[model samples]
Target: MNADSNGLSNAEALSRLIKYGPNIFRDHHELPLLIQFLSRFKNPLTILLLVASAISAFTGEMTDFVIIMVMVISSVTLDFVQEHRASKAAESLRRSVSVCAIVIRDNKTLEVPLVNVAPGDIVLLSAGDIIPADGFVLEADDFFVKQALLTGESYPVEKKPGPLASDSIDLQSATNAVFMGTPVVSGSAKILAVKTGASTAIGAIADSITRHPPPTSFEISTHRFGLLILRLTILLVLFVLLVNALMHKPLLESFLFAVALAVGLTPELLPMVVSVTLARGAVSMARKQVIVKRLASIQNLGSMDILCTDKTGTLTEARITLQQHVDPQGNGSERVLELAYLNSFFETGLKSPLDEAILDHKNIVVDVWKKIDEIPFDFERRRVSVLVENGESQWLVVKGAPEEIIGLCTCYSVTS
Candidate 1:
């Protein structure tokens, strides 16, 4: 498990890849269409109605059997068609975005799909790049990572290449290790990947939740209703049989009478009614750009009066706005925005949220300015500087965290 500057050779990487398999969390699987459709009948109430329909058919009551079967089939079909279409659309949207990672192999750096990333690969990561797998930092320069997904701490944690202490028993204390699914907040690092795919920490969480989810509220209620109907039907059938026995009625006629009474008591159209109603909700929600994978979930959503979230930005569109541009004295300054717009417009590196907001705030005429050089932002510096020149003079425009910018400045300008 040792790595040098050249990283693992192609032969060795391929061998390890075959041994460990690809680095991916293959947690979800789609069932066959027939199986998915048949699964709808698993509902207790639906199963009961199905059994009642079969019994009616066997008892020479074709009319009763036809009515029950048609309602059940129509209900199941409506639910299946609506949900299946929505899920397919969701899948298409998901496939549009692909993630890639930078890997060093055969003494060359290459960008490859995240799934193709294998153990022993040297992964190069920087700001905004997600960690491809669990690995120890081999080389880092002021590297900081956001482990909020695993540790629930919103602040970024600094990581450097070093040996873990003997007391480092938990993930929170694993300072030298970077895990899968964590995003690099700032700076850059080179890691020797030790674990990939299901062996990684996040992959384990995905695997644990891969099984069938617990039944929803709608399912529980329907099951209870089925049990209630079963009890009442049994009681009524027994009472009818007893009355016929006391009157000395024929055995076949008495049994048929009991069966007819049970069929009459069963609500054949209830499933259809519920399915159609939920399907309508799904259609309306689709119009509003919400994908509904389960019709029953529509009911659950309707019942929720207050939606709670773990944090403010978690449910947002991730779009930030430039509310105001000001100088050091809290007075509005178009000069402040002019420099920001120039830097954001000419910078060649990855753009941050503030940069985007500045560009979106307003259009500034920048034809007179020509770019000269640039310094990219990193965790250590916490700021980015762009050197631009007009027809006569050059200006180094900087934008970053207020504290970082103030620390670097020896003098300040105030507008009053």
Candidate 2:
């Protein structure tokens, strides 16, 4: 795609849409019809039922044939309808890309649709904002992002403006790269777009969903069982035919008997049973906190020997709280507690559990502090220092990990 003086040219944007837009799973009103048709004969039990019906028809048993055929067709039709409804509901839950973004173009900031945000666009991101595109950070201030959706990490990742090592950097370690779907946990930033739409990291996930292969287990099992039944039915039919041939019996009568045997050998209820089993398993799992996005994932989960999972979100509560406070001065230096409360109260960007606990202090009057200078927290420093001016005096307040803060001060607190 070509870039115009403003950004992407009209032709370029159209070309990108042609290449990438079609891949996006936009909600379609006709999706229900498509899903219904696809669901037929896809389940194992259904396959067996259909095979049984075919055998009954060949046997010349009109009553039995009609009954089996009706049952098979009705079951398949019901399954198709249910699947169609489910697909339509899933489509309704898909996130929309209707919001416009404020981006810098030719040293001028302009608002444009998120879909039109091509690579190399400078996007302005702030606290509580969802990243619109994948990009490299050019500048950031106390920027932290929650990447649980992408990496399954519950903790907010601290981001910095620097050149990331392309060879060694993975998505989690790409300190410079900001991705779509993740929200800015705290602070603001200016980022240069590296990828957008289908080319983005999240876009890769969308592509995986689109190009997913058919259910291997269901297909293989149904085919195997069907072949076995077909072989048995053929043998039974041959035995009857041989006897009829030796006895000089009527050919029509013998053929009808063989067809009846074939029909009985086929398992017409197989599809319905398999469908019910899978649906039951899926519903049971839903009752748990884990949501199985793909139905086939249930089978895959069973086959896994060892699962390597991210510990951030899945294992941790995603909240950091103060477990203990040691006031060694014995004078009950409430000033430290008060200062911590004031600093947390003024911090409008990030809201962690530690900040919540500090805010809960009843004795602290954080609003009394006037205008002042403050230093934002950094992962490397592990501390946040604030200089607040109250009347004529300026108080230097600091809060961080216990070890880091204790190391900076010479005094030690002894418990009674």
Candidate 3:
């Protein structure tokens, strides 16, 4: 789709929606409650305890069997309940955020739910907005995107509309294309959606992680502990059986003694203890406004001594501050700052970090300046202009990259 042409009509968008499906990763779909509850039984410690309870039942020790089974069921149920609550809380938190996309439909721009975005739709992206689908840029204006999710690059990359080189094969080289899940760090763009749902790059990555996630440290440790316990129990039981056989003890008494020893060696309350601990951790984190869908992840996070994560929003505050505004002589200039504030404040496009910094640096009284017209920032010109009239006179204020703006200046202001 070209910039001048109206995007896909309403009927065509509907047809494409049916063909492409909703724009979602699908990995977060909730499993059936029964299936989720049953999954708790798959824990190694729980399974081992269940086995011990089975041996108790087989040995005609009904009291011991009942006790062990009760403890195991209680632990599993507790864990399942805690995780289910956490999942519900997370879902509620997610629903609280309105995830919608602006798309061009039937010659008008409309904000629709993210899932409604389909192939052939023209999506509008602005600063602080995550790209909703994989698409080619139809128009761009100093558009910079944080593609750390896809490229692992800490710096934001500039994107513009153009034909890519023949050697452009990786995500980093696709300057004309945008992918889902990456946030627009600055500027604005209009893109033609070409891929949605699981077909998008981030969706495929999410699917891979969901299907073959590596076992967490908690899982691995529990499995090893369970196996260790099983090995020790087996060795002790065999040693006791050997001694009893050598001594020629009564068969029924010896068998009962071995069974009793095995049952005693098993840690029936281990599952309950772990589940309780994890549940408490989950509740503590939830109180801090951190929603945890998996109780085990709390342990994982606690165990981390040095976390190596992206710098976008994890290690640093996601904000930009204006340190100084100066003229060519490197001296502070209130005039320059006010002009920048006027230019940024009057522009109607998505506000970038620089614009926000300018507006927030100092409060300037703009009641006298009436906005007339604006030339929105674009990649080609690398600048934004605002036409302002102050009753008797009119002034055109411009802000942009240093080199671009300097190239257009006939004279430079050394001081106020």
Candidate 4:
């Protein structure tokens, strides 16, 4: 095979890679532990509580000040630790899903790290492989791709190359195009990489995950509750200070009393409680084989009214087994198995799952046969025929969908 016939020369690929960054999915890293701790104090209530703790220290109330400091530090540390662990756990998962792709680079076939793939490079895809970048199909053989990870549709979709009649089309409907992160269910394809990194369709979806979503119902309710408590605390403190002043109490004493009262009224532990709860939920999910990247998503999961997903790879174990192999006469036939095994082993294009199933029989063997020529399977023809020679004898074996192949058969072999 000519190296130049496959894809870009090495120099060209390197130049394009320099122009466009490596293919990668970008994710937001969590803030530093110290920064996350400081973030806990960003809220008004936490700040108010800190001020009270300081005032207590200044007034020589050592016991109260120590208790307040301990509460603040304990809450901050718990929240920070849980979040840090969750972030690290999610990172491991992201790394696990990262895959490498086979490409033609410098005119030679190479299995490069997926992240190094650049736009315009040629990639070869086959069954059980994951696509690492977006591209148009240059050539295909019975190519079918399962993009349920992106489209939530379990059915494997066939891919083609011609331009659509209308430009307005959904990704699932784009037969001529393939996107990153999808699995090749069956068949094989040669693709011209056109997009990578943040520019690919899946990259856009990954970007969406980073941009924070609108506040959920639980968050809205929590915000309202915080505001309500803040308003009530302000009113109560004012009332107490006004009473002390009316009774001619010392100004300093009244001020300190009001400060203490305000601190007591505020729900300083709300944030801590929420964080711990979410962290625990994340831990539980991890134990049950679910990875929750964002802590806030736990609430959304609980509040979700409708959840929809495919069962093919999720709810059950999907596997193919050679349950039974029979001939036209409705009897088990070693001859049928032998012929099918020869077809699958010799006539290779994009190997189908059925071909795999047929080839799995332990008793099947075809070491004596040699392939001479093949009638390449095509969309319109819908059949594949292979001419094989065993010693001096040569015969053509054909297989396809029953509807398409039935008319071509004028005679039936009903014997074993």
Best by lDDT: 1
Per-residue accuracy of model 1 over 1-416 as CA lDDT, tens digit each: 76677878778877888999888876588899999999988877788789889989999889989999999999999989998998789879967768899999889998989988888899999999999999999998768888878866655677888888899897867889999999998789999999999999998997786656787898789879988887888899999999999999998899899998988888889999999999889989989999998788888889999998775545665677999998878889999999999999998745666788999999999999999999977655878899999989999999888898888889888764
Clashing pairs in 3: none
Q: In candidate 3, what residue range of length 10 has the lowest lDDT sum?
A: 310-319
Using lDDT, rank the candidates from best to worst.
1, 3, 4, 2
- Model 3, 84-184: lDDT tens digits are 88767766876787689999888899999998998888899999998999999989887889897887765577889989979998998899999998999
- Model 1 clash count equals 0
Q: How many residue pairs clash in each candidate?
A: 0, 7, 0, 1
Cand. 1 Cα-lDDT? 0.87
lDDT of 4 by residue, 295-413 (tens): 77789889889878655455444445687778877888777777777777777656666776777756554677789999876766888888899898998888888888788988877
TM-score of 1: 0.75
lDDT over C-alpha atoms for residue 169 of model 4: 68
Tell me the lDDT of model 1 at 260: 89
TM-score of 4: 0.72
